[model samples]
Target: MNEQIVITFGNEKILTELKAAHPDRDLMMYQALSQPGEFMLLDHSGKDSVFKAPVFYDILSHSGEDKWDGFISFSTLDLNFDQQKVFDARINKLRTNGLPDGMHSIYSLNYHKDISQRIILGTWDDYADFELWKNSSDEFIPKEYRDSPNFYSHEAYYTPAKTKKTQ
Candidate 1:
């Protein structure tokens, strides 16, 4: 039973309950049909139900194994990007600008689903280069993150999940 738990629109009961529980905290819960195990969390800090979902996420664990091999998707904008750059160059950038098989479509591996343990890390494929991704210099599939030792990366940080569930 090695399945990762996620929030879904069909869980309206949970959603409504979550919404009612933290009315003061903003929430943007929705269902994205394109990706199944996917859930949208737009600035969802105080209102992340994944922390309170079930036994699965309640004791969340992360692996730096081979399957985490996806892009850190992000929209092509300077808004959060620049701030993120200021924050650190190596943080997982999971969102996208909607291009043909682009980063926006590669959300599975880039964000943190920090569950019970309170911290999960998202590492990029070593070839991660914003300038390269946006440029027409060359088009090619990227190698694994372990390919280059010189690859720039962000220092690991701890993000505490909501240990208390209203439900």
Candidate 2:
């Protein structure tokens, strides 16, 4: 799975500033409203991601980060306050608990400009199982979204979650 940043934005001013800051970023900003707002930035300049899925390793794969810079995009609306806190703690927990450290990062894109979320730029490695991420063609289903999932619930987000065994 190619790693891309997910941002949720319904605010015009904040979204505009963000767009201006990183016009080159491979960003997927979400809009709750019916109309997609205009972007006041330059055209996309980076190579399109070569994202794929790992079917056999469905549960083992990661999407946030792998061997390179990557981001997990999502909406806060999907999670309640407690779930949000749990997610925040778990993501940080991943930085220290597992064999690999600093492998992924979770970012929320909201309409509130008061929140300080910056755009990150660098090479990103796909984290999710290639097959599993690819087989996710059911975007319209109640649970799935093309790439902008309202909430990112994966096996890696919690302990006891396993991964490919390196030899």
After superposing candidate 2 on the true structure, give the runs of residues whose Cα lies further than 4 Å from its correct spot: 1-77, 98-123, 127-167
Task: For candidate 1, write residues 70-140 as lDDT tens digits.
Answer: 33322221113343333222223222223322222222222334311222223234224433553542222
Model 1's C-alpha root-mean-square deviation from the true structure amounts to 14.5
Q: Lowest lDDT 10-mer window, candidate 1?
A: 155-164
Using all chains and alpha carbons, the TM-scores for the candidates as numbered come to 0.28, 0.27
Give RMSD to native, each candidate. 14.5, 15.9
Model 2, 1-167: lDDT tens digits are 32222223234555445544565564343332223442212112234322121111011123243322132222223444664455445444543454222334433322223222222121123334322432552321123222555554322111111112222
Candidate 2's error at 71, in angstroms?
8.7
Whole-model alpha-carbon lDDT for candidate 1: 0.32
Error of 1 at 141 (Å): 9.1
Screening candidate 1 with a backbone cut-off below 3 angstroms (N, C-alpha, C), the clashing residue pairs are 72-93, 73-94, 73-95, 74-95, 74-96, 75-96, 90-154, 96-104, 126-145
